[model samples]
Target: MGVLGIFKKGLTKTRNFFSESFTKIAAGTGHFDDDMLDEFEETLVRADCGLPASSDIIDTVKASIRKTGNDSREAVMDVVRKRMLEILGDKTSFELEEGKLNILLMVGVNGTGKTTTAGKLAARYKKAGKKVIMAAADTFRAAAVEQLKSWGERTSTAVIAHPEGADPAAVVYDAVQAAKARKADLLIVDTAGRLHNKKNLMDELAKINRVINREAPDANIHSLLIIDATTGQNAVLQAQSFAEVAELDYIGITKLDGSAKGGVAIAVAYNSKLPIILAGLGESVEDLVDFDPIDFVNSLIE
Candidate 1:
């Protein structure tokens, strides 16, 4: 399916919630009064849009209503849609450069689908005819290396790994050398999720980055911070902590299908000012898609 179709289908839960709540709020008059607007702002917060974003959007809606002298639901919703789009920033897609070793360093807290996302990306790049390799750099976590190796098996991609408790930077150094020797186009490194100790995690990432720089200085790299939409505002806070240390280039939002908290995307964007490069709309490998700002906002708030 096309990107628009994918977004529409994946955003079913959020769209349904939006429809139901707005229908209830606009029941008789089909227009918003002060009381209706107050309740609607609460609804946005409930949808996990975050306080700052919801407040900003509602302020925009109120100003538009005052300027147009139209309190109709159509007018209000249009204002909301446009404001949301603005909050998401410009539209962009994820793409690899030709004849370069592109590295996607997946980082996030535990249970945010970090390794699964790395596997899906390997599958996707391999299907696109790119030479892809997976690096199981999450050596500290139990079973993390095995899980990434399994993904490598499923995708027919080779995985470079070390024994658990091995230095993660050593894994990165070997992965970089292997990619160069094999002339691979992409290398996906799945790192451990240990946010409970931010300083240690940051130090580990720094060491791995040093290895990559020393080993493959010419490679194109993107540090992708994964966020679970199901976690709502908590995900936003976690992302902020990562932003302070990870030098993140993009965010990959996962688990959007499991809840109506899809507005977490908006919250993340507002807080981080970073582009969301990927969306995990479902459990299937094929369900992962590039985050299209226009399509996402249309499917969500309409």
Candidate 2:
């Protein structure tokens, strides 16, 4: 399918939620007034805009209406759209820098498809003539390491994994060194999908990062937080918490093919200020696509 066609499916679902909420708030016939503003604010907050951002958007819309005296529904919507984009900030584009090897660390809670997405990413880069190696850093789960190994065999890419309960950081350290020695094009680190005992999450991720940086200081290391699109507002909370722990550079939102309220993608991005780098639409290896903002916005409105 075409890019627009693929993205439209997701955008349509997200827009439906916002549009329905906005419709309820929109007046039958009146200039932008206090009641309309209150309604709009309520709608935004319900859509997972968060308190601060929701307030900012409402304020901007009110200011625009006051300045232009154009309080029609379309006018209000136009202002909302502009304010939304502005709140989203400069849309980020994620591309592996042209170089020998690019290392990416994938992290998230369980059931977020973290390992599956890593496998899919490796296959894509390998197909593009890049040597891809996956490091199963998720030592906490017995099945996670095995799952990544299965993906490695399927893609014909090498997977370096230690025993279950092994030190996750050591696995990453070894993987980085091996990738450098083998002249691999990319080293994808698959982290554990659990956040049990808060201290473990903070210490484990920090140690893993330190090990990788120590081995390959200049390696194009990118940390991606995988989030389940089906989680709705809860996904936003996960992003916020992960951002506090891991300095995440991008987001990989999965399960969009099944999620009815994909507005969580926008909520995550707006609240955390992290760019969404990839989206998973289906089970195929090619189901994941890079983030496209215009296509995303068009999908919502059209």
- Top-lDDT candidate index: 1
The models' CA-based lDDT, in order, is 0.90, 0.80
lDDT tens per residue, model 2, 1-302:
78768776655656787777666665567456788788777766665556567788789888987898888888877777777666555657556767757889999988898988998999998888888899999998889899999999989989999999999998998899899999887999999856655578889999998998888888888899999888877788888788778889999889877765565666777788888878888777778887776666555544
Show where candidate 2 strays beyond 4 Å: 23-27, 30-32
Which candidate number would show the highest TM-score if scored against the true structure? 1
What number of clashing residue pairs does each candidate have, in the order they appear? 0, 0
TM match of model 1 to true structure: 0.97
Indicate the worst ten consecutive residues by lDDT in candidate 1.
Answer: 88-97
lDDT of 1 by residue, 19-57 (tens): 788789978998999899988998889888999999999
- lDDT of model 2, residue 39: 77
- Model 2 deviation from native, Cα RMSD in Å: 2.2
